[model samples]
Target: MTETKKTTIVLFSGDYDKAMAAYIIANGAAAYDHEVTIFHTFWGLNALRKDEPIAVQKSFLEKLFGKMMPRGANKMGLSRMNFAGMGPQMIKHIMKKHNAMPLPDLIELAKEQGVKLVACQMTVDLLGLKPEEIMDGVDYAGVAAYLGDAAEGNVNLFI
Candidate 1:
């Protein structure tokens, strides 16, 4: 019998391009029959956020944070040359012109491909993010869970 392959990625960056890279890799690994897990921590958790605002009550600080951070993948700024938020728009246009998948679409494809998408519970709490503010079909766990997945993965990456 053959052993199954495992791939685990720790997505720690909030940068749009970096998150796209992480999701692309996860999807590729899943296509190759690997057990894939993406651990979204800190700013990375933004990738799982819903594009629309959720009417949830929050502390003052929480509200401030929500206002400062991008609401979803499409709203996230690029790692470099953001140029007052025009960089992402230009990239999206280029991607569409080439028939390339956007970050949000890549994430959806990953979910459809059965790639495990996990949001760091601790990070969520720390960021004052409510479960209602995140998209559906995501698992919540802490560092220990991420470590366990990473331990079993033949390929491990931190984005």
Candidate 2:
């Protein structure tokens, strides 16, 4: 019997370009019949957030976090040369010109390709992100869950 190859990525950055890189790699691995898992923690969770606010009950602190953080991948900024948030826009325009997929489309493609998307349960609590605030088809897990996959994976990356 053959063992399934695995690829585990720890997505710890919120930058638009960084998140795009993570998803691009994840999707590529999945295409090669690897079991791909992306564990999103810290600011990386912003990449999995929904574009619009979901009607969910929240405490004062949770509400504050909701209001302060970027709503989704579309709102994520670049890691450098952001120039007051114009960097991502410029990059997006360039990507379109080259006929490359946008970050949001890449994310959806990863999901459609059966890549497992995990949100850090601990960070979710720390950031006060409600369940409804997250995108659908994501699993909520702790570090142990990520470690389980990483331990047996042939490829492990931190993005």
Candidate 3:
């Protein structure tokens, strides 16, 4: 018998590549008709911003850091590991090779595909960011809300 897979992802990594992985996986899972909810928390909340456009810095130091650090969701271009110093370049190559859809496009796809995105309220309060900062399409909820979803017998993963 094939085991049914239902998942809720508590995404805590704000690194660019990590966010991308979560989004991509959620999209795929949703495509397969599984229920998916992504709970963005802590640093991961950075990826949900509406005003901040994710971009790679041009400075040599920032580029170097980009190689060493995680770029966050808006910037993840292709290394599976954000801190591996190959994230952006690898993402670009993978997108090119696979004709991968862009993040904005992916967001639309996920919406149409029934993927649910939730931003953690605690993170928002801690960051002093308003609810308006997050993209229009996402839902804002507290930890208890996340737990409520996780409690529904879905496979919960902290990614």
Candidate 4:
């Protein structure tokens, strides 16, 4: 019997392009029949946020953090050449011209392909992100869960 491969990714960057890259890799791995998991931590959790604001109660600091962080994947800025946030807009236009899927669409494709999307529970608590704030169909787990997956992965990546 052929063994199914496993791929684990640690998505640590919140940058739009960076997140897009992570999802693209995950989708590709899934297409190849590998069991894939994306462990979103710290700022990377922003990619899993719903665009609309949810009326969740929070502490003052948490509220401030929410206001400062990008609300969703589309709102995230580029890692470099941001040019005051115009870089992402420019990149989106170029992607459209190239008939490339946007980050949000890529995320949806990942879900359809049965890729495991996980939010770091510890990071969620530190960032004041409630389950209601994150998008649906994501698992919440701590480092141990991710480590278990990574330990058995044929390929492991940190992005």
Candidate 5:
């Protein structure tokens, strides 16, 4: 017998750790044949834009400056995770070596695996993002719409 399952992830952080964690979980859930959905808002919106490139800080000054910069969501800037001494470089290297896939690719895979991707309209306006900025295969909707879907699922995670 095939038992269906539902899981929803409401991602609110734009940092690398949060983004990657969400992708990992989404991929795992899809692998298990569970229906998955991702709702992105605030800083999380950064991950949805196809044209929004994530800049790599080249030096200590740049990194420090980035720290002072107002991160769009969660009172934190979209900084990369430091994996001990190796830092973001090591993290990226390991991910590439493992063929773990990029966040955008994971998102696409999730969608291909029947995972729904939703972008919050309010965050769009707040961030001054246009409809064209969103990636292909994404649905733009208000928080209520996401809540409606989330309310029906067995699991909902805020990353």
Candidate 6:
């Protein structure tokens, strides 16, 4: 019997393009019959945020963090040429014109294809993000969990 090949990605960027790249790679790996995991940490957690604020009681700091961060993939900024946040909008327009899948759609597709999506528990705590702040169908785990996946992965990426 042969073991399945595995791919692990540590998505640590908040930029729209970087997040899109990570999801695209993960989807491609899943298409190639690889078990894939995308571990979202730090600013990367922004990609997994919900579009609407959940009605939950939060501490002052948590509320502040929520207000400061982008709500979801659509609200994310680009890593470069942001131009006060116009860069991501321009890129989104180009992507739409090119008929490419948007980041949010790519995320949904990845989920449908059984790619694992994990939010870093430590980062979540550090950011003061509650469970309701993130999208549904995501697992919360610590660095040890990510390390375990990466240890057996044939391809490991830090995006």
Q: Which ten residues in a row are the worst by lDDT in model 6?
A: 53-62
Give lDDT tens digits, candidate 3, residues 24-138. 8889888777888989887777667664534532466534533443233455433346445565666667887999875657667777887888888877666555564567778
Worst 10 residues of 4 by lDDT: 1-10
C-alpha RMSD values across all candidates:
0.9, 1.3, 6.7, 0.7, 7.1, 1.1
Quote each prediction's TM-score.
0.98, 0.95, 0.71, 0.98, 0.74, 0.96
- Residue lDDT tens for model 4, 7-84: 999999999999999999999999999999999999999999999999999999999999999998999999999999
Question: Per-residue lDDT of 17-42 in model 2, one digit per residue for the tens?
Answer: 89999998999999999999999999
Cα-based lDDT for every prediction:
0.94, 0.93, 0.69, 0.96, 0.70, 0.94
Quote the positional error of residue 64 for candidate 2 in Å. 2.4
Best first by TM-score, ranked: 4, 1, 6, 2, 5, 3
Give the distance in Å from residue 156's predicted Cα in candidate 6 to where it truly belongs: 0.4
Which candidate, 2 or 6, would have the higher lDDT against the true structure?
6
Tens digit per residue, CA lDDT, model 6, 1-159: 488999999999999999999999999999999999999999999999999988888889988988999999989999999999999889989999999999999999999999999999999998889898899999999989999999999999999
CA error at residue 138 for candidate 6, angstroms: 0.6
Clashes of each: 0, 0, 8, 0, 0, 0
Pairs clashing in candidate 1? none
Q: Against the hidden true structure, what lDDT does model 2 obtain? A: 0.93
Please tell me which predicted candidate would have the highest lDDT against the true structure: 4
| Candidate 3 regions with alpha-carbon error over 4 angstroms | 1-5, 51-72, 76-90
Clashing pairs in 3: 15-72, 16-72, 67-85, 77-91, 78-87, 78-90, 78-91, 79-87
Tell me the lDDT of model 4 at 131. 92
Q: Candidate 4, residue 49: CA error in Å? A: 0.4
Query: What C-alpha lDDT does candidate 5 achieve relative to the native structure?
Result: 0.70
